[model samples]
Target: MFTLKIITANGNEVIHAAQDPIFHQASNTITFQGYDNLSNSVTLGEGLTSAGGDVAYLMGASGATLATWRYRQPVQCGSSLQPMDC
Candidate 1:
């Protein structure tokens, strides 16, 4: 497994697993979850997927970007949906 570090414009950092990090994706939105560096708890985050950009902004609870990460192609997993395969 790999880690995705999201760095915001204001310097806030959120870390997430690179695998299966994207919880939801739509025509214009991509929703995800990660751990806040300060709290170490899972925080809900979102990003835009409409512009076909390699980078996406991860939004915080206040609707501001807490961080950003480069988009990576996801690998297909087997029926077990194990992390080792995804």
Candidate 2:
């Protein structure tokens, strides 16, 4: 499973997926359930992707940047379930 961690000024949030999270490449929008420190669920308002699609700007209902999600490259270790040249 792949986990996305978003760092924010308030604290940190996370999203889990069986694969890499999906987002609109053209619109650069993303929708996901974000967990708070208390493990409470909240809907991510709207988000924007970076030009390189390497970063995501998570916004709040008020259109403020709540957190930032950075894309992490999958590990290429031989033992990993996903195949890759190592």
The candidate that achieves the highest TM-score relative to the unseen native structure? 2
- Score residue 37 of candidate 1 by CA lDDT: 28
Clashing pairs in 2: none
Off by over 4 Å in 2: 1-53, 81-86
Name the lDDT value of residue 17 in candidate 2.
30
Question: lDDT tens string, model 2, 9-64?
Answer: 33345433313235533233344433432222223323343322245454544556
- List clashing residue pairs in candidate 1: none
TM-score of each: 0.27, 0.28
Model 2 worst lDDT run, 10 consecutive residues: 37-46
